[model samples]
Target chain A: MAVYTEVTDEALAEFLTHYNIGSMVAFRGIAEGVENSNYALKTTQGDFILTLYEKRVDPADLPWFLGLMEHLAAHGLSCPLPVRARDGKNLNPLAGKIAAITTFLPGVWPRRVLVEHCEPLGAALAKLHLTGAGFAPTRANALAPDAWAELLAKSAPRADSVQPGLGGELAQMLHGIVANWPRNLPTGHIHADLFPDNVFFLDGEISGLIDFYFACTDIYAYDIAICLNAWCFEKDFSFNVTKSRALLRGYMAHRALSEAETAALPVLAQGAAMRFLLTRLYDWLNTPPGAMVTPKDPLDYYRRLRFHNAAQGPAAYGL
Target chain B: MAVYTEVTDEALAEFLTHYNIGSMVAFRGIAEGVENSNYALKTTQGDFILTLYEKRVDPADLPWFLGLMEHLAAHGLSCPLPVRARDGKNLNPLAGKIAAITTFLPGVWPRRVLVEHCEPLGAALAKLHLTGAGFAPTRANALAPDAWAELLAKSAPRADSVQPGLGGELAQMLHGIVANWPRNLPTGHIHADLFPDNVFFLDGEISGLIDFYFACTDIYAYDIAICLNAWCFEKDFSFNVTKSRALLRGYMAHRALSEAETAALPVLAQGAAMRFLLTRLYDWLNTPPGAMVTPKDPLDYYRRLRFHNAAQGPAAYGL
Candidate 1:
């Protein structure tokens, strides 16, 4: 759903001279990443993805994202390694934006979530958390509890427009969740938005993880919570316990979960749901109609929040 | 610009089973063709383009388009060849739409037209005409002069909203062009819409021509007229006689234009301009303001039409 920038062939040929990837064989704008312009580039050597960071992406965070991808790949995780130019730099200027190339990974992301996809997704998420421990760079989660109040204040007036009593329900839930938020959980780098589209698979196995733009430092279980909300829900927003059970089983198989983390699963899941719900609510109300990218329906996450709010404990997650 | 239909990984794997191409290595929806869903597909064997024909295309016309492509490629034209499945069929079904895979051509389309591009483009157009003689399919041009009057009638109501007196000017021009439209000098299969985006260049040479969905039976000179309007005008809509001269010279070097075709250049070019102007006017009036694909400005073609209308025969094009 992207390709916001147009690169002239002349400019592209000039850009490729900085890299060692050889002359361009073919290049095309790909509808993959949302926040940037992405081109599927082929050269004499191999295939690569060329990305031009749009205004939505903070240029200051680019180095961190690229560095983290390198770190994860170095730690035996499958991910795109940023290709550095002959000048020994990954980032360069092109088409009035910061651009970079990364080695292309071969796989297709699952468009339809299946029950079998949940377990491998959980294992990959756990592996990412474990591998990221050695990387020292720390970025605070931008959409944590502290940002919820302002987000609510901005979208509260129109939240009920989407569904009756939605604003009030959100307000009450926010108050309770903030008051009971967990502490002392294991903290590490987490992919806060590990949706199905960001993980690619080949032959029913996870081939690579991508889109590290949303990677940040957060509680480990909270990352798992995001996955449960993203990967274990049906199209109708109903929580599938079987998929959830397999997911947690996969995670525990990689690294054992602490008793404290297990006890906090319900609140953590609810918090994860609220995090997405607030952002989606803001985007829902603010995005202009007929924009290229449609905003996700916030009420889907509302249903998820309700499911987590009523859960008894980790057993409800089939832990 | 496209990717209207979402293909699932499981569905795509099943679709590829019919093809001899090895298992999928990588697949991504590319923002290339406007009229269909295009994916840059890579297999264990080679690169290819998977196109799912959308609603805008008529299903009955598929064979003719594929046949013309095959005909052109068999005659040594550097265009994409439709890759047949194991069943010896080029077209199949995927994602609820008719799909086909074509051998991926290696080159990038020029974003900005250069003087050197015009000559090779002209030579290629002539070669396409010569090679297409064996193609017996007789699909009429949907945007020919016969259809211009009705198109004008549809957009006449709001044409003035784009500019005062624009509607009357268009009506008058359409009448004159249709009335004075020349009889056939030489008729053959023509790539009726050979725009810069449809022609790919590599190392200052025209490596391949593509997007043959608009190919049809038409006068050869009319195709040249379309090229003149497409590649010989500056961004400001001023006619570049230098490029036009190179184009015609290069074309004549391949297939010499008859005296009648040369004499009819002004009217044919004006007719080409009118055809595009009417379509743009209709789309300009109909498309929503914030739609994903912005309609082109009708006035650009209007200016070209005026230039062609005022020309002193082929000499104005530096022939």
Candidate 2:
């Protein structure tokens, strides 16, 4: 639900002159990405998405994101490929912001996570990791384990206000996650934020992946941990072992996990939980009252963090 | 910029069971009308718009609104026609609200109104009035003259807080508008809110009309008055007489205005300006600070009211 900048008719007509896509038939602002403004565009040629990167996205990182999409798409993955303008450049300026057009992928993001969705999600993610090996560009995860302490510092003082004793509990969890963080396993570009909304499906099969703004170079198994935390949890914050088994089975079918990687799932999952909990807690405590975006309840992630912290080993994750 | 209700994948799949339109290929929540939850849907058959009527729209009027759209499109007006389901009904339940699907209308709404857009807008609006004569069901404009006092009463207390002397000025203007409200003018169905966003254009020609939730039976000339205020005003709030003249000329090429209606243009325009001003002022004063939807500036309409109030006759409107 973001359209921070309005493109005037004159500006749009002029902007389209730089692209070879046919004349604009219909265009509309769409509620696609939160950090950037997205528009669903239709033309005499085909359907596409026009994205105007807002201030939250660094212009320096945009080319990497677009290039990753192109690389994944070129290797037979179904994803949005950036449409180059007549000048052979993917990034251009529109309405005082960097803008790009991507070929529209056909599917709807599953609003509710289903057991049937997890296996395909696992396979798609593993496929992404496997295909990303040849891409030369490397971007460190901005929200990596090293960065969690800085986020915790900003929110720890007030975290207790969200839940009784949350501040001290978060401090303990952060220290544990940082000390035990996995160092040496598979590494590649991982979609760090592959939540249900970022994965699209058609006919109960994975059709495409989107929102690569959060994709970065990290341990491949850490990507699995993120998906486990995102997809294998029930609404009650309880882990579903059946879904976990299905997800891991799907991932293993594509690329077998190393013994070290398999053994490190618990700590990686906890770290993943900590990353989201800290951010959500920060947003919950920091978002001004009556703000447009109501922050997610931090307590949900807090409960998941406690579960992951208590787990004995990979067996607890049904690996 | 709204998606007030989140439709689950299961609900959408079940809901589509009632429609013969091909299997869903893509669906995305779009920022179209502010009053309803709209999703742009692409299916194997073609593109369409799914609208979930929010609480602002009365459920009883849903059929009438759809009927009006059906009537208009049946007579070749190039508007979205309601897509009936296999059960031969247009309105159905989805996500706990009445929802309907309409054939998608292609073309972009002009972000910046231009003089070239004015003539076609006027001609299309006149055609709508002429074609609307056979619609059997009649809906009175809910925001008619009688409703202003109640709205003003709710907002008047904080009115002066928005401006130095707006409260008293609003009261006086309401009195004059209501006292001299036109009695008899060629009345028919009018798209009460025919602003730039409701009209779509492609290839420099009007393509479609939309948001029929605001359509109602009212003075046909009053619709003209509303358009004169909407399409003929420059961004700085100055009246553009050249655009006004072009609009009136295009309108007259379709249907001639009665002498009484012609003479009443100034007062009608003033009253039209008052209607929008009072509503916008009410929203401005009543909406809580930092709410999701930022209220439009009431002063813009206040300035338009002043211009229309000071006009001498239809000549001032470029007759």
Please give the range of 10 consecutive residues that has the lowest summed lDDT in model 2 chain A. Answer: A286-295
Poorest lDDT segment (10 consecutive residues) of candidate 2 chain B: B286-295
**Residue A208, model 1: Cα distance from true site in angstroms:** 0.7
How does candidate 1 score on lDDT? 0.91
lDDT of each: 0.91, 0.90
Question: What TM-score does candidate 1 reach?
Answer: 0.95
Q: List DockQ for all candidates.
A: 0.61, 0.60
What 10-residue stretch in candidate 1 chain B is worst by lDDT?
B287-296
lDDT of 2 at B185: 89
TM-score of chain A of 2: 0.97
Looking at model 2, residue B136 earns an lDDT score of: 81
Q: What lDDT is reached at residue B156 by model 1?
A: 91
Q: Which residue runs does candidate 2 get wrong by more than 4 Å?
A: A155-169, A282-294, B285-292
Local accuracy of candidate 1 as per-residue lDDT tens digits, A1-319: 7888899999999999999999998888997777788999999999999999998778899998899999999889999899999999999999999999998998999999888888998899899999999999998888898889889999999999999999999999999998988999999999998998899999989999988888899899999999999998888888899999989988888978999999999999999999999988998898775565657789899999999999999988887
